[model samples]
Target: MTQPGFLFTGTPLELTDGEAYHLRKYWKKGRQAHSIQSLAAFDVDVDLDALRTLVQLDCANCHLAHVASCCEGGFPFPPAAELLPVLDEHLDGIAALLPLDVIRHLLRKGLYERHLETAGHRTIGTFDGNCNFCIVEKNGPACMAHRYALQSDLNPMSVKPLSCLLYPLDLIYSEEDGRTLLTALTERTAAFSRWGPDYRLDYLCANVELRENLASADSPNIRENLPPDVFAPDSYRPAYVEGRQLLTELYGAPFYDELHTLIQGGRRP
Candidate 1:
């Protein structure tokens, strides 16, 4: 009588038992996030440099900078298998930031081919199973590749790679009848209004209520504020905006403009 997921009329979506299993375990945050769909909103010309500054300002406490203490080092969970070429192109740019030993191991092992065998989408270094590029600092883990790309004059997509550029925002690829579908979704948000307390507490999203609870007409917390003055040093880029940027990077400027126009017209993706 009841559905598997919660939300609107399509609530309790159709699912295989296996799919249901993971959905039960993981969809709290997901179903709530579906309410607004993070990509529905937009913030242009976000000051990524300012975001870097914020991460630096409170490096220890900010959880995003953390290493993979749970697993090996911090495998960036790289792009799909097919995009390996695009991912490899940036290795030269990021190599300078890595240790020689790590570099040597990566080269000796033959980069993607070897790592792909063991780690699947992980960016492993050496035979030790650690991601070659994650620099474990005293505070946590920092990505040399990401740092290099942000600072470099090159196009971030060409040099930065998708995994690093798109962290909190996730891309899901699926196949149904004949074609493939790619969906980008945010992990968590405080904007889950159509659900219950269990959903809000169990769902767990980031930066959702940050906008409402902090930003005001004046003296706003920069990270919580969106649609900020692009020229300002404190402009904060939301995951939604970055998702658009990532899409643009993968496709082109025209795709981003079309997507933006569609979203502005209030059509669902």
Candidate 2:
């Protein structure tokens, strides 16, 4: 099965039968394993182990500190089919939120026309190393489209690219067994073929040790050189806990419920 083009560019990791089995074994640990196994009867499958390992990230901190942002990494324009609904329904709202210059450029360049010309697959334009739609803010860069959607009382996902929404957490479809796998970037997954780029090394959000080291540093230079509260461990939380809304939105409440049940040792309120 041919995978649909995503905003981000990366070869999807295809797991061999043996590799798949091993990955499953790696997941079958502790009480969570029982819940992971139970998911086979559900509509979606998850990489609970990988998700559990991702402890914390402060996106605002990362952006304010001028760290490498996924937005700055040029990504493809989501296929026209994926964008048409938004443009058809909310184009005016989006245009209203963007700077006049950007709107003028889009009009001159034929924003909708470009989607058709590129056959729904082309690199999105960038300015100053960030996505052109990004508005620079004192706190951080924000997507104008997303902001517009929120202001209009619309779902941000309706306008935001799926790739942008599902960062860190990767949804992989396997041709080998015809299964859809949900996983994330972890040390083990980074070593193996996994979705998205291996960002476990330097990205503060992905590296726990780096965050800890930065958080605890006492050197005068170290203290002065970095952003205030950069990589603060206090901001950290389990990936599952942090990603509750996204997970529920993507996989439905039952899927997230099962995950929560397993993580909380079957405790329910």
Candidate 3:
């Protein structure tokens, strides 16, 4: 019997852009409630308290009922050296509770690069502080706060709220039926079945999630105007072919070759 052929559908996205969108959205919306509950009207730890104050001050006018659409798919706000003193003042409390150093490093790099293109600063990289996804190098040494927490024997990852831990993973799409779906094709079987063999892996690799997050947020128009950055060309790609290619890349010639033999000899699903 002939095996079932799968077709690819959906759009592709830039991985960097996806990461930026996730981070900004989480920072802007995901933590809003927490900020109100934990930080608002409090002045305990300098750093945490300051962060709470910042959130409260900024969100005093959060008129938007649904937060999902508010995120503009933008990069993180670059870390400001001006905020260093505030961070330093609350370092003890911050370091005690969370990965202060890591947070600082990421924020600083973001600031240096000016992700949002702040007023009077439209440059992309004046100091070339962008990370090429090398977590250890960019996310480590610069983060003494994170290192400090590790030395104290705390589960930093657990202490981190869902927003921080679920950075790139927050990518999801929502359907009219209201089901949330993950887009990362981390497995071969999944890639073949959900995304189609001919689907554009490049876009998939970048856009971890889809319209779901955008739909749930304040910027509902994003789903309609998500630009052809990743999804346009992907709609026509076949799943079986793309799946076969992905499988070959992951398992190598010997494994894929053997798998192909087995698949060809088996009945269609």
Candidate 4:
């Protein structure tokens, strides 16, 4: 079994020989047989199992009530080489959109050069378990870059980091298969030792049971403080549908259409 290279830098669970073997076997059978040729100039193989899983992403609830799990623990960032283009093209615009402190940090750190110092793939800076670009208000944390994109009438993903935009949907390069695998953390994948930070599926957004439990839990803090609507079971939707915008932005409409078709058990359009 081969160790797959993650597209972004983050600590992945190391697999033992037996675990790796089982993972490879499962992956071979579970992933789409053909790669979807993405507009990003890469072929992506979607995990059919992961795509079909139901999920609910209440980002505000995660930030205000629970921990912002995705924002911490060395959250993935693109390599410096890849980041250079983003910086060159959008750094000024992003800085203008963000707060003064964030802009100051960017200037002080020298962006691409700073990433190179941290082994070519440095995680984005976080303060108080939230992303630097995250503006924490009474409502919850909001991404400055995303707000900028929306205000500017551009796709939110256009200004945000690829890894940030994708969230639970991961893109990993399979060295053995020579193609990128697009997957999400689901119960079946979570059970395997080869696939995670181990807590990827523990969040309210990722786990339907957690959301349901939290919604109906008899805790005063939950009922009095937390937002009830965010954890409602009705808020849950299939991962494919919830992630449609980011997926289409990253891979193109055709890629999403093909994935939707595959998930629906229909021939690719």
Candidate 5:
């Protein structure tokens, strides 16, 4: 029930110092002009090929709808107060097309200025009861806020919460150096491919018949792990591109270009 925020965990992260500082500033100030730069490479276990092959994918397939629900506890990233005002100007016609609860939840969430002092510390998400802004009809799922954002000329980053934008991808920070590393909570890298088939990417490579490990490296004490082989193949091209975008957004374009150059001479797994 407690939606503990990844940033609020206060752990020594696997990211670069600059990136971590950028996220920390976000926690301190709701909206900030982030300095998208890297301090060092801490979580770059996989190369550009593996990095490029990962994907965030559609929310319909993502468990985030039923999981996180924007409940980043202790994280100070709040929704912008001016978003609804901007949406109101654009969503007049779009509101009718959405589900009633979606419209109602959006109205309820944006009704007043919610402050941490008045609202108190909430461990769970503020609007997980029905997802605050999800409007599901016969035609599949649609995010009302995203729709309104698209119609309006407003920037979603200025309006929507960062937790929503950075779902699954947790930008963890280091305490001493303020380094930050990006990671997917849903997946994890084994200690040098200790787990059978590099399970961090198992779900993505389900179709491929990967080799099984002698034992699981899930535990810290596990000794024997597989070699860090390039698990990503040609089939995972889409995920690679998606993952690249997330990296680019977080680390800026230059970092991505440098990594891409390194992978150009990379060999197939």
Candidate 6:
């Protein structure tokens, strides 16, 4: 018999709470520190819709959106587990789909010239139903590196760069931004590739191709169709600022005073 097409050779990935904390810290420092106007000047779009989606997506998946948020990245924030069974019912409708080997190959590619050569050996790894750095223990069926379907928390669906966040949708520092905000150069290029320069239908075509793949493969994982998830915001300071804002708004400056005490004491919360 012919070899089964689309063999899932990938090792399953998991997430953990500690990893989630670190990831969030990295993102805030990496993505949100820079000005949006500069990003737009650099062909980054900075469109509100895409930006919202990016934040929503990233935070939901990685728990970088906010403290006390869910630790997972996927769409629909809280996708119903019941969809899995429904998806199973349509598996037969998706048989002729081609294997997304190209997509997988891209996932393994390094953004920086020496990325894979160096960082390739290191991985966040998996844990009990999450990445070793995951904050949310239980999650719907999806991959943290690719899908943002069921992710909860402060979503940064568009924060892409380095080898950790999704590119294209997840923009990060270009040499121009130096040490500040991350932009969506990759995501914008992808969008332009699909819907720009006389290829207005490329986005639609990609969507169709993805749907066909989903039907053919019996899997609903997003990484199977898109690039890997790799994002690095300017720093975690943005997340901290946002968190501080939330605390201040909800509680008051006194809350921040207590937070200072806890931070001085080396407490995470």
TM-score of each: 0.50, 0.68, 0.23, 0.71, 0.45, 0.24
How well is each residue in 82-183 modelled by candidate 1, as lDDT tens digits?
A: 456665777787888888888888778766433443234344343355566666565432556655776676666665445555434433221221211122
List candidate 5 stretches off by more than 4 Å.
1-43, 47-53, 59-128, 151-159, 185-240, 262-269
Q: What clash count does candidate 2 reach? A: 0
Per-model CA lDDT versus the true structure = 0.40, 0.54, 0.29, 0.56, 0.39, 0.28
Model 6: runs farther than 4 Å from truth?
Answer: 1-36, 39-44, 52-123, 126-130, 133-171, 176-181, 184-219, 222-269
For model 3, give the RMSD to the true fold.
21.9
Q: Name the candidate, 1 or 5, with the larger lDDT value.
A: 1
In the range 177-199, model 3's lDDT, one tens digit per residue, is 23222222222212222222222
Residue 203 of model 5 has an lDDT of 29
**Per-residue lDDT of 1-269 in model 2, one digit per residue for the tens?**
65332222122224444555545554444226443433542212234446665555555555554445545554334533444555456667777877887777767754532334234444345544556577666443367776777677877667765656565665555443444455567666553223323455546565555556665533222222455467666766666767777778767898788777756666545
What does candidate 5's lDDT look like per residue over 117-184, in tens digits? 32343211234443444544322224555556656675554344444555334445445455544433
Q: Highest lDDT among the candidates is held by which one?
A: 4
Question: What is the clash tally of candidate 1?
Answer: 5
Which model, 2 or 4, shows the larger lDDT? 4
Candidate 2, TM-score vs. the true structure? Answer: 0.68
Per-residue error (Å), model 5, residue 84: 11
Best-matching candidate per TM-score: 4
- Give candidate 3's error at residue 138 in angstroms: 11
True-structure RMSD for candidate 6: 19.2
